[model samples]
Target: MGDELTEETGHEARAPAEGEADRRPGRRALLVGGAAAALGTVLLAREELSHLWWRLPGVDHAREDGAVDYRGAQWIAASSANLRRADRPDDYRIDRVVVHVTQGSYRSAVNVFQDSSHRAAAHYVVRRDGHVAQMIRELDVAFHAGNRQYNERSVGIEHEGFVEKASSFTDAMYASSARLTAAICARYGMPVDRTHVIGHAEVPGADHTDPGRHWDWDRYMKLVRRARTALA
Candidate 1:
C-alpha cells in the first residue's frame, strides 16, 4: 500500500510539470507581441516629429505666389504680425522701400526684434549671406522709424552691417535685398525709382541714420534696377 501511495504522488507531480511546459509558447508569443507594439509606437512618433517641423498651424496649404502663409509661420504672432482686420481697413500699398543696417550680427537683430524691451522691429532682416527673414507682415506697420507716418508707408529692410566705415554691402546681401524690394514693388504696383527706394539716411527726420556713408549708393541702385528688370 505504501509503494502504491508513492507512485500516485509521482504521477501527480508529473501532471503539473507538463502543464507548465505547455505555457512556454504562450509566454514567448506575448513577449514578441509587446516588442512589435513598441516598434510601431516609435515609427508613429518619428512621423509626427517630421510633420511638426514643416507644417504650420492654421495654414492648410501653400499659396501659388512665393509669399509664405503668414498665419502658419512659427515666428509670427497674432499681436505682432497678425494685426486685427479692423486695424487694416485699407489694402496695403507698399510705396517706399527703406534700407537699414542692423549694426550687429543677423542673430542679434532677430533677438532685438523678439525682445520686447528692445522696442525695435522691421518688416525684413537681410543676412550677410543674402538670407532674408520677414519679421512682420506687409499689412502691419513695423516700428522701424520713430515717425509713424514714414513707418506706415514704408517697408523697412534691415541689413547686417555697421555702415559708418564699411565701404560696401556684401554681394549676397545686396542681391537678396534688391530681389525682395523688386518683388514688393511688383506686387504693390510701385515704381522702382530713387524716390520710391531710399536709404534710411534719406528718411526725412533729424534722428534717422542708417545704411550710412559706408554703403555704395550707385552699386545698390544698379542692383535694384537689375532686379526690377528681372521681375518685370
Candidate 2:
C-alpha cells in the first residue's frame, strides 16, 4: 500500500506495480538487510562494540550489582572504580585462579576494596573462620593480579591474614577456600591442579608474594581435589 523506506539508504523502496509480481522485499528480506546494516556498524565500531554487547538484552544480561558467584558467599560491592568491567569467558577466557593473602583481616580487605584509590581487589575474600565475601563479580575483571594478562584471564581469591603466619592458614579456612576454588574451576572447566590454581606470587611479573610459603600447597591441593570430586 505505502512505499517502504530502507534505513541504510533512506530511499523509498518502490512498491511493485499492480499485478506486476509485487517485488517489494518481504519480511525475510527486510531482516537480512537489517542484519547486514548491523554487521557493517559493528565493523566500523569494533572496539567500542566489544564492551557494549553484554548490555544488550538477551545477550549476556547484566547481573545484579551484588550478586555472588558462590552460593554461600556474602555479597559486598567493591568500588566500581577498583575493577574493570568485562564480559568474561567471552572477551577474556578465564582459565586460572590466582590465590592471594590479605596480610590483614577480612574486614580490612573489604574496606580496601571499597576504597577507589586502592586500585586493586580480588573477586572474593575468605576469612580465617571460613566466611567468604564476594566483592567483585566473576563476570568482571578484578585488579588483584599485578600483571594485566593474568588479571584478565584469572579469578582472584584473597585469604585473610598475613603470609608469614602459618596459623592463619587454619583448617576451616582451607576447607572453605578449597570448596570455593573447586566451584570456580568447575564453572570454567579448568583443571584442579597447581597449574590452574596458583598463588599470586606465581603470576608472571607479580610484585607481591601472597598465599605465600606457609600456605601449604600440598595439603590445599589435596583438599581442592577432594572437594572437586565431591562436586562431581
Candidate 3:
C-alpha cells in the first residue's frame, strides 16, 4: 500500500523487522530507492516530506515569542498547536497572499485562534477600524488554508466580519489590509496582482466561500497597488 502523508494524517511507511518479509519499503528505502520506478515515485511525492521538516527538533532557529512582523500591529500569539514553526522563505518560498474573512468579529476570531482545538489560524487579522493583530509569525506556517501546499506557500490574512455583509468591509479595513498585503508583497518580491493576492474561495479544494461575493476585488487591488507604490 502507498504511504499516505497529509496535514492531518502524518503516517509514514514502517520498515519490516530485520528478518521479516520485504512486503513494503520503509521510509529510508523510499528515500534512496534503487529502481527507476521507485525514484520516480519519490520525485513525484517529495513535497510531502517538506511539510514534516519543521517538526524536527532544532531544524530552525528559535524566535522570540510575540514578535510582530507588521510594525504597528498588536502581537497576540496563536496557540502553539495551531501553527507550525519553520524557517520560511528558506525552506518554503512564500509567493501568495490568501485573503480570508472571519465569519465573526475581530475578538471572536482572535479567541478562536488562541484555542488549540480550532486547529486553524492566520498569520494576521485585520479589524474593521484598520486595526491589525499579528497572531502567528510570518516565519511559521499557519493552518489557515485547507490545502496543505497553499498553507505552506502563502500568508493568510483574516479580515473581521462576515462574507455576506458588504458593509463589514469598511474603508479603514481595506486601506490597512492593503498596506499589510503590500508589505508582504514587497518583502517577498511578489507582484501585487490577482493571482498572487487571492481570496479563500480561490484556493483549490477549498469548500469555504470567504471574502465572498461582497468582497470588492477592483477596489481592493487598486488600494493594494497604490500602497505598494508608496512603499516603493
Candidate 4:
C-alpha cells in the first residue's frame, strides 16, 4: 500500500542521486555566473551605445561638428568640418604645440572655423585682446597643421590678426597664448623648448609662414617659461 502511495506521489519526493547532491550548488553557481556575465555584457553595451549617441546632434557633448572646447575656453565649436573626433592619448600622443596666425580678425577667423567647406580649424584661438576661445578639444585632432604626422601629435593655437602686423601680436595676446602653451606642455609632459614648441611655418611639409616674422619667439618663450614655473 505504501509503495502504491509512493508511486502515486511521483518523483517529486524521490531522493536525489548520490552525486547529484554535490552538483546542486555547482548548477546554481553556473546559473548565477551566467546571469552576472549577461548583466555585465548588457552594461557594456549600454556604455558603448551612450557614447555613440553622444556623437549625434542634440546630445549634451561636443557639437555635431566639434568637441567641447579644450579646458573650458569659450566653446566655439568648429563643427564637423574642422576637427576629427578621436580617443586621444589612446590613439595618439600630444607631444608638440604648433602656433598659427589667422591673418584676419577674430570674427573672420571664427567664421572660417564654423564654415564646413573651409576644412580648417585650430584647437584654440587667442584674440588680439587676449580673450581665448577653444574650438576643439585636446583629446581630438584639429586640422591646422599642414603635416599629417604633426597634426596628429600637436595642439594648434591660432592668434587673431596677420603675422605681418607686429601690433597684432600684442603683449596681452602673447601673455595669454604663452600661458596656454605652457599649460599644454606641462600637462603633456612636453619640454617647453623651441623644438617641441614651433610655429606653423616650421612644420616639415612646408609652404606656410604663419605667426611669421613678428611672432617674437624670444619673449614668447620667456613668458611660457614663467607660466610653466607658476604652474608648478
List clashing residue pairs in candidate 2.
none
Off by over 4 Å in 4: 1-72
Count clashes in each candidate, considering only residues at least 3 apart in sequence or on different chains: 0, 0, 0, 2
Off by over 4 Å in 1: 1-92
What TM-score quantifies how close candidate 3 is to the native fold? 0.79
23-60 per-residue lDDT for model 4 (tens digits): 34577798999999999999989865654554555643
- lDDT of all the models against the reference? 0.69, 0.91, 0.91, 0.84
**TM-score to native of every candidate shown:** 0.63, 0.77, 0.79, 0.70
Over 1-232, each residue of candidate 3 has an lDDT whose tens digit, in order, gives: 7875644558775666899997656787776666767778887678667755765787766787667888899999899899887788877899999999999999999999999999999999999999999998888889998998899899999999998899999999999999999999999999999999999999999999999999999999999999999999
* Candidates in descending lDDT order: 3, 2, 4, 1
Global CA lDDT computed for model 1: 0.69
Rank by TM-score (best first): 3, 2, 4, 1
lDDT of 1 by residue, 1-232 (tens): 2333334455333233544655434777999999999999999898545544434565333333335422222343223432212112133345888999888888888888877666668878888888787776675667786666677677888898787657337888887788888887776777888899888788777376788877877878788789889877
- lDDT, candidate 2, at 23: 65
Q: How close is candidate 1 to the true structure, as a TM-score?
A: 0.63
Error of 4 at 166 (Å): 0.7
Which residue runs does candidate 2 get wrong by more than 4 Å?
A: 1-52, 55-58
